[model samples]
Target: MLFVAGSTVLGGASARAAEQADETSTAESSPIIVTASPLPVRLDELAAPVLRLDREDIEASQASTLGALLADQPGLSESSFAAGASRPIIRGMDNNRVRVQENGIGAGGVSALSEDHGVPIDPLSATSVEVVRGPATLRYGSEAIGGVVNVLNDRIPSARPSGGYSVSGGTSFDTVDQGKEAHGALNVATGNIVWHADGFRRETSDYDTPQGEQFNSWTDTSGVSGGGSVLFGNGYAGANVVHYDSEYGIPAPEDPADPVHIDMRQTKVQLRGAFAFDSWLRGIDFAGGYGDYRHDEITQSGVVGSTFKNKEWEGRAEFQHGAVGPFAGAFGVQYRDRDLSAAGEGGELLAPNTTRAVAGFLYEEMSLTDALSLQMAGRVEHVKVEGTALDTATITEYDVSRDFTPLSASAGLVWNLDGGWVTSATFQAAQRAPEAPELFSKGPHEATETFEIGDASLNEETAYSAELSARREGRGYSFAASLFHVSFDDFIYKALTGETCDDDYASCTDAGGTGTELDQVRYAQQDARFYGFELEGKVALLRTDTATYGVTGQADYVRAKLDGGTNVPRIPPMRIGAGVYLEADRFMAKAGFLHAFRQNKLGPNETETGEYTDVSMAFRYTLPEQMTGGASVKISVVGQNLLDADIRNHVSFKKNDVLLPGRNFRLVASVDF
Candidate 1:
């Protein structure tokens, strides 16, 4: 049994899952689908490593931000830039290398351009989340070079509810930040039509750290979504619209006295449909979306200092067929267009730009035998970017346009052993085109306090990677492990230039002008290598019809360096954790602790972070059905950082100035009818 999405082993034993399996495994039941894939197969058939969080797991975490909710998972970390601006970091990769998506579509936002911008999608809207790494990333695009974080909300209903309608809602409160949230969702079905609607609101004051209150570190956000679907005998058509808004403050070390924050608004619309065929073509699925996003950085005087906006649209179609004997697969084609601009303070950080790309991908699998299978995938994309670049020789801005054709491919072997054990080995070669900001950014970015420089001549980045994974699942025990290595040619990175500047880049390169103000960094390329390993295991010591006891342990580590041995910036340190728990028919309780080692692998001009221990405890209870009129009611209390240790995220750029929230407790209540 497993309390995660998709496979029992690949999704790892999450923190709460470490307690006990809530339900028994069933071989006759339908397999959980991994929506990240255009044409997903069964769990044991996957050739790459993955981690997933189902609805139950998500409820227990109840984090305010998506990044914070997943930070404890194996092989995952967050930028921790601020209370509202954190983003997920996977396999020691962040920024443009990791893709953040929603419901099988790209979450069109500017969070990747800088660490201070927050991802517009909230976990409150997600029913589950998947973290996919390794060769499987080819299914998306080179943008997911490191990995992909796909948040599945299913706003559009494809099937009817058990009853004519179903309703669920809840409210939560926390002590650490004095935060409160309210959310509700409804689904209704009428004959062949299904409808869905959901909304949420959240607000929080400054949070308390181990030292004291963190000033200007608060968050306020809300969002609503409505959708419906029409189901036919052989297929279905659906559409959804979403609106999100948020405003949060940033704790800038240099301007601590002056409050700075971001005000954001985003609207997204999506349309999708599926059709089944009787000919050689099995079926076809198509989806498209449009998004308009904008965020304004406000200064102390309440004036909009810098405004960033992005308008984008994308569409893709996937066709499934078994044209080749003994082989089944899907082919997909995608097109995307994006326009972005910045205005007001430090507006020159990046001139107005537009990026367009078209791609075609193929995935095929063959069962060599009942116990062995082969999986192959390949993708080719053509990309073009328009922006402005600094003409170093001429010392002025110049119009620039660059084009690239990137190709990626992978091959893997999946083997099913005896006693429910599975293993996979994969090799991939991927190429990525430079993003707009990576090739055209100039002038200063106030959020990071850096004078940025980009090179239009930058070439495509390429990676050659290999991965080996194995897992075993049984009634009483489970184990999972993965090891991966990646070698990159011309890896793109920002290099510090040991110079300082003010509102502009002028005088930054002068010998006497260097100061403790904004630093100067230029995008550069170099050969690099990254390697990592993850391990998880759990054992059920006692089991009964109504009660079970278990113990769980997990460990993960990653190392990355430039060809000359220089450590990569903002890499998460290794962590080892273990826990114990008990489960009863109506009550459950669990406790866990994780210890992070001291991070001494310092990047250039960076300081090392101290080690710390994080401890958590939780208790849950469900009311008797007789007391709720056949409805389900649940209450839970969760305690985090029970150790009250002063913690700093080694993977954050603001780690030196900002400390993680201190000891805190949260209470939640929910009902399903």
Candidate 2:
């Protein structure tokens, strides 16, 4: 059954409604800025759903990773191996399907391949985070079919002498782990030349859990970044470079018989430059970047391995001219090349792979009328993959090559109505090619206790999605609701056929042949569908000289089907949450509770996960007098599984054996200068 529910309000209608609700309300309203264009545009004018996490919001959340912070936002989910490893899921899609962008460019690292790996960029360093919930096909490549999460930092050398330094030291109660970090950035300007430099180092000890104490786990990370620019008559040109390294791992239990242990390390380097033109081709911009990354992992199964290297190069050019009526457009081309090689023990090459992609796109935003606008975009990408397949039997390999061409497009309309109401509707068609691991993996997945498999004949997956939203903004109260549906063909999934090896373990075998049992894993394609609704709003309750307070509420429900069947694995359940925030000029506090609905409907091969709830609180304040040039202190307390609920994330692969973190507490403190 296809379900669609929601009422659409015209653009600017919410603002009118809010004005009608209150005449004395002084709530400041502003449009969100998005990097989806060569030139930024206001979110309300972009004709898509874009969530902006401003600097104040980031400081208030006190999250450790970008994935963790984004999880609580609408249309986002999180999958975590531990506190140190968490990946973000967007609209029921994850892994390579979602693109993580840094200042409109790719992160160019191993984060796209594995779940346990962390994003190399630091979340605290970002000035803001933007989550583009609609098709970003015009700005990014085919991989961004799901959406784009851009982390913007101060990478560009500022032409002003302004910068700050921060130092923080804290400890975790639940993990009994202590950590310290320091970061400093300086920007100097002289005549037409600007120089900037920043560096940071962070270290942490092993962590402990309520179940027991985990050992051998520690984290050490250090990085330095610098850039310089020269202002000229035509434009400003700049060059930037960054080098980073980190070593971290998950420890085994103290029982000494545990077989699960992971030790991982990574190092990355990037160089980039950009230029803007003023003469001849006015409003034209160009930029290019190069990146190299290396990773190594050591497991307890004697499968010591290392990935030697992967390099990426990308270039883009765009033109923008707004004086041409209410119609503005930008078009550009991008190219990326990635090469990777891996080796096991004895310095033996497991498999070597290389991929190249080229794409071109155009985006146009037109103001159809005074209150109505339209956004149209389209992109085409050509990707080629080539590599040498390892033949374990004869110790010989054969060459493999494949190419794919996919096209994506999107259209959206925004209507501005009176009475503080705003409405938008969007339709998008996108496709994604298979990732490297999905096409070539052949080994044991010790973590899941299963033999892994892959097929080189896999094809691209395609999807079509549509969404409608309505929002009303008011001084005393506000509300917004959205309904969305997405359908996919050739959706890739892992299936279990109720077959096992004689060794009493899961294994794949030739059922029609001589009954020879091998590994127990294969990637298959299936038709899939997802539909859901999300609603969120806030209300200002009280205002006074000493204190101001507000209430916020949000709810989400999603359902997915595979091959027209009711069973779909790894789907999150309906959730509802509410919170209150109180603040003074220099002090602020927040408390909230989250409830997750039970998931009883399971696929023939699915497991059931019970329902649960949790509560959390935080507080922050500024010092009376300046200890240094500038000073502030922040403290927060978070209690996971506050109800002591024996709950597990329904979407987790480890749901059968592991439980979410039990009742635990975490406290944090930081200072800025």
Candidate 3:
């Protein structure tokens, strides 16, 4: 059975009839909804490729960060320099080019400003996650030109439970880091009223590597959320509140004698509503949120060295429409306002700034034939930033204001061929304004150990891209492949200036820098291009009445370069992997081997990374029923990097100074009541 929101395509007529019945009965028995999209569209019908991580997937991975959760996916890699802080690199693009969201709303954090800052969302508390690479740029913003990662927690009660109440809980432990995690969720409904509550906590010691333990690699995370809603005849409305807090160490090279840590906290409130209609418009959906986030960098002496804060409010509204002469789609409006500031020792890196943005978008899909369809989306936005910059040395202050109008559009065509084969082609053009850090930063960043300078004259970056994908799904075999290329005009990047500076911005004359050996870097613009290919397939080897076995293989590679012949920095190496799996009524197991090819294509002042391979295995077993509603307890064991080989992520800035985690093992258990 193929399960998707709005539409479910099953293998047989009986299966189709069963799905229809479930859709009308309870949401738990129905297909998962695609909340990331403006209009409710089936996953398979989407013009662009999407990667989804369900609750089961998240539980099995035992990932500590969003970057680690997606690092293994094709065309994706983790910054991986530090265990406590890392961001996803999509299709060779990272930083501001990628957008992180919680339930389709901006994270309202400063993770994009620097590599050491961690994303505030807690993956352990999420119900599902969705990744989109193309069309998301139109609906969300130009920052999604690289991709979008939407974490769906369902904090706001969207629907009522079939019964009076439902409860779920899980716990896990990892050997590599001596880590422990636990989470629980509850949902109760009475008549037209529904309520929800969830909480999660995680703690870990410094992780162990093949050589020894990585210093300052510990993490502590916790979060709680509560919400309630009223179900009206027309639709449902709800509001939610969430609190998240985390404190983690920032591992440093052997050179640094003192240790660093980050203390962070966030409080967020969200309101959502949806209404069904009987007119040309199908329904209206709206969501709005406000967030207050703050973080402090602590030194070994127990003093707070630097502090950062972000206060933001964001909202979106969209109206779904029925088919009208082969046209069906949704139009929406979005607004966001953020005030960001920094203080203390490292405050000079970025001036306090406030940004405001307003946008309108339209998306439409037309069915040209039984097997052919076209999708197009466009967005226009106005953005403004206000700040004040002061020259401390000269005791002079200056007013800073910048404004931009960014536009983005995308078109795609999907053709359903015979024999369950499908193909899609997409082209997109997107523009993104320079972020505050890229436009105004003027001092040292202690976390990244870099002396940074920004360019106020930088213009908005623009990208044009095209992609072609093909897939064939069968009963015993399946395969997918895609090729993509992108060209950028005025790509903004940090370039090394071949100058070194101490923490006080004083010239460092010693070869072995004592205070801080940080190179000076300046934001610059250049014409660049990136291209990649990804392929994945699975084939069944044996099948029986109650058991089946299969083999899977996947490979992906990306290349990037500038127009003037310099290679892009920190590009992920090419990777190929294979795995085998067996499934039965009560047990399931899988094993895999992954190889990362050596990367010799070096950027200016960059070093090459050696190749490495990893071995991983996992298995799960369902015990006898122990709860109501056919809910059975399940236990899972997972192993990663079983080889214990030394590994380095080519995309990581600290690859040469630090090694990736060694062999790891995890035991997880979950139950529903």
Query: lDDT (CA) for every model shown?
Result: 0.80, 0.60, 0.79
**TM-scores for all candidates?**
0.94, 0.83, 0.93
**Cα-lDDT of candidate 2:** 0.60
Per-residue C-alpha lDDT of model 3 across residues 447-516, encoded as one tens digit per residue: 7778777777789999999999988777888788899999999999888666677754434323344444
Off by over 4 Å in 3: 1-30, 253-256, 388-397, 504-516, 626-629
lDDT tens per residue, model 2, 524-600: 67888888998877777999988889887788887878886856667778888888878788787777777788987
What ranking of all candidate models by TM-score puts the best one first? 1, 3, 2
Task: Give the distance in Å from residue 279's predicted Cα in candidate 1 to where it truly belongs.
Answer: 3.4
Top candidate (lDDT)? 1
Alpha-carbon RMSD, candidate 3: 4.2
Report the C-alpha displacement of residue 152, candidate 2, in angstroms: 1.3
Candidate rank order under lDDT: 1, 3, 2
Quality of model 3 by C-alpha lDDT: 0.79
